[model samples]
Target chain A: MKLATPRRLILPGLAVAVIAGLLSLLAYPFPDALEDSLESHRPETKAAEEAGPRPSSEGSEGWSAPLPDYSVPGVKSEGLGGALAGILGATGTFLALLLLLHVLKGRGRRGPNG
Target chain B: MHIPDGILAPHVWVPLAATGAGAVAVSARAARKRLAEESVPLVGLMGAFVFALQMVNFPIAAGVSDHVVGAGLLAVTFGPGIAVLCMAAVVTIQALVFGDGGIAALGANVVNMAVLSTLTAWAVHQALRPAFPNLAVAVSTVLGVLVGAGGAAAWVMLSQPYGAKFLGAMMVTHLVSGLVEAAVTLAVVKALRASGLVPGDARVVAR
Candidate 1:
């Protein structure tokens, strides 16, 4: 089978990386929305409402559930930063992989295949 | 699902990290032996493909979306070692670049999706190879999808001190997603086999 040239492959790979990076940024806001949705409908909160507030118990102080705070202080900047980072990082990795493949191809050509 | 930083408990993250490290080490050694020089570019491209595919999320019930975890498909096409590597790279890129997942939870994500899924698929492929050689790839792909999704749900359930309703919701949502993943994996494997990207002659490639 004819191997795909590094040049031929890198362009498409780079395109994919860029797209993924952008999508990640676009979806960053969605997480907060999701968190809000989850929090509002949280079972614990629902249960607490259904059953009247319990008396403060000594043992329960140490047993609070650890839920993450998904609220972003500055949603706009954080989303942009995340998108830029993702795009740059993915592109860098794709380029690095392409370079490696190019080097390997050269070595293979110089070996027995020559 | 990419569990962001501060979401998963430290105990869960630490143990998963250890497991992921071990799996990655083993996969690296195996990859060195199995992956050809020519395969490197293709593997990288596959990583890109997986990255793209993961972004296309389908809405599940309750307004949540789930994406395909392609580890099993990669394993069947590229062997377990390379598949794991591909998955780890994809996850790493997703976490660091996009902030989709927490850096601290990276180990847990890798272990759940990459290591467990690929290894389980590889095992299923091995066991079913003799009886249903032609169907081995399809069976393994489906099994991998199921195992990865179920295993992930199980991990989340065990890790979180949540009620049964939440656990059930997570598990059911993943189960549906797994079915979609299985179909996609099967189609990809069949297409690759038809196109000769994966050798049609099972005996030659199986070795």
Candidate 2:
């Protein structure tokens, strides 16, 4: 079990990050399986639908995401915004994971002198 | 399946999220024992690939769509512990940065998206490998999707009384999409193996 340095992992990880960012632009513009499943369960009663999250409802309004639906704020163009968001998301995820693994890897390695 | 914030009751999401967090913790601890300098880049790059592939959503029937979950690839290539850790990072990023899953329901998203998906795929692959070596990846991947989707459906069903009826719908749709998952995972695994990135059907080095 040999470990590759962070430097060696960077290229491959960044390649994936870039590819994901690019491919994300082509993601289907429709509800995914889970979203579709939830939609199929549309409230039988109008009241139920109204009770749950709506455009101006509890769930939708409760949390405000910086990049809602993966679109950059004030970015009018869907493709550009989504592409930017995808790149950012992919890169961000890679970097975040790298940081996390670094911390995990560093645990208990402290020398007695340090 | 990324569960949004408002749909699930707090009781359901709370426990699911707690379980997700706990599993990540436990998996992290386990992963630490196996974490090696050589394996770090493999896991890191694979995680990036998974996060990237996840964005490509292909259409499926009944207004549903499918994408590469990649848990099978991770579980088979690296083992379940690292797979789960990678998944946690991917899903959490989707939630916080992309708004794919609701923040409130992050727990459910993590569990269905990665925890169950990775674990089930690994379990199925481990069980079938000795017998259906060729088809094991496909079988494991499809079952993984089933588990991920089924677990999500089950959670929603428990939280909502009307949810039970829709379970069949989710399962059926996922079955259709599962084919795509299998194909994609198989392709990626073969590609990884060919590139010498992943050892050939080797037992998890960590395991």
Candidate 3:
């Protein structure tokens, strides 16, 4: 099982990252299946509806999301914000995984290929 | 599905959080020992791919959409241990940075998507791959979603007695979404193998 050299893998990886980031801009705005299923189970009483939104749990109230719902803060255009967030998120995840794997590398017995 | 905060009771969330953290620790050890030097970049890129793919939710029904969970994809490409670590990273980022899943319920979400989903998918793949390579990838992915969703439903039921009634509905919805997951996983895996990024003998490489 010959491994694809890092050089060979880079182009495809970048293509996927970019394509996925761009495609994320077209993400449907509808609630996901879990959200919809959970919503259906909630009581639809008049008073409950009138109560507005329920409060978030304790210890998490003070926290603020830098890019809430994958939107950039103060970004006027939804499409632009989402796109930027998507790119940023993909980059961040890629970097984070690299750092983690690096730190974990050589901790135990080396793999056969290694 | 990412479980939001406040839904899970303290008792439920606390123990689960500990378990999630412990599982991640063990998986990290396994990954350190088993992961290959040349595979690091591929693993990171795949993690990014999964994270990005998750952002694109496809609407499946009235008021309902779903995204690629990608645990099965990672499981087939790398292995269960590394897949779990990658997914844990993705889920943690979603909760802390994106606020997609609740901070409090992070443990539950991780356990469902990262641990249970990846392991179940890996198990299914290993069990069926020899006899049905293509079929294994698709079926394992669908089953992964089903198991993950079932775990979520179970957590809800344990935390709140009334939540039990929604299990059937949750499974039904996830079954539809699972097919979508299966299709995406199958397509992506086939492409990876064709490109030689993932070898024909993926299992041998993964180990």
Model 3 misplaced stretches (Cα beyond 4 Å): A43-59, A109-114, B163-165
Q: Could you give candidate 3's fraction of true interface contacts?
A: 0.63
Docking quality class, candidate 1:
incorrect
DockQ of each candidate, alpha-carbon based:
0.13, 0.53, 0.55
> Of the candidates numbered 1 and 3, which has the greater lDDT value?
3
lDDT of 3 at B48: 84
Worst 10 residues of 3 chain A by lDDT: A50-59
Candidate 2 Cα misplacement greater than 4 A, ranges: A1-18, A45-47, A53-63, A108-114, B201-207
Best by DockQ: 3
TM-scores across all candidates?
Answer: 0.70, 0.89, 0.92
Top-down lDDT ranking? 3, 2, 1
Top candidate on TM-score is 3
User: What is candidate 3's lDDT per residue for B54-87, written digit by digit as tens?
Assistant: 9989888876888888989988888888999999
Residue A12, candidate 3: alpha-carbon lDDT? 74
Chain B TM, cand. 3: 0.97
lDDT by residue for model 2 over B91-113, one digit each (tens)? 88887777777776789878986
